[model samples]
Target: MSVPFALFTHCGIYEARVQDTFFVADQPLDDGNGNPPAGWGNPYQSGTITVTGQRAVFHDDLGHTVTFHERPGATSFLKLCA
Candidate 1:
């Protein structure tokens, strides 16, 4: 088994990629909170993730899509999830 590649952002979006699976979130990834955000059963659940070189694509089950572009020295727009 391969370890998932994790990407932490300052905006509270924690992402991980393993094979063709992907997980992303805007809050802490956990199940401690019984009331998780809509669509997400857990805080950091996997969704549809796709990567092509420096570009990453995340498609949420809630019809939302997030895209990330990797660049050198790019300032992060996300903050650590509390």
Candidate 2:
């Protein structure tokens, strides 16, 4: 089961598509301040997603990872792609 989704953090927006064993993103992870961390090159890149329970872990190709926690009953203006 593969799911394509978008992720928005304090850093920036990312478009990601899930695969059989992993997921890939269309951009490099940001530093949550709208800038890439030190030693990062190219704004566009790919990554992997690891979902465990209610959390989603994004592992970037640059060796950086970010974890997002699920918020129950959270509301969003964005809609999932059909």
Error of 1 at 75 (Å): 14
User: TM-score of every model?
Assistant: 0.40, 0.44
Worst 10 residues of 1 by lDDT: 1-10
- Residue-level lDDT of model 2, residues 1-82, one tens digit each, is 2123333333343333233222333344556676545555444335555666555666655576665555444443232322
User: Cα deviation in Å at residue 3, candidate 1?
Assistant: 13
Which residue pairs come into collision in candidate 2? none
> lDDT tens digits, residues 1-82, model 1?
2123334332334544444444344334333443334555333534565666656666655664556555434344333345
Relative to the true structure, candidate 1 reaches a TM of: 0.40
Overall local distance difference test of candidate 2: 0.46
How far does residue 77 in candidate 2 sit from its true spot (Å)?
6.9
Looking at model 2, which ten-residue stretch has the lowest summed lDDT? Answer: 1-10
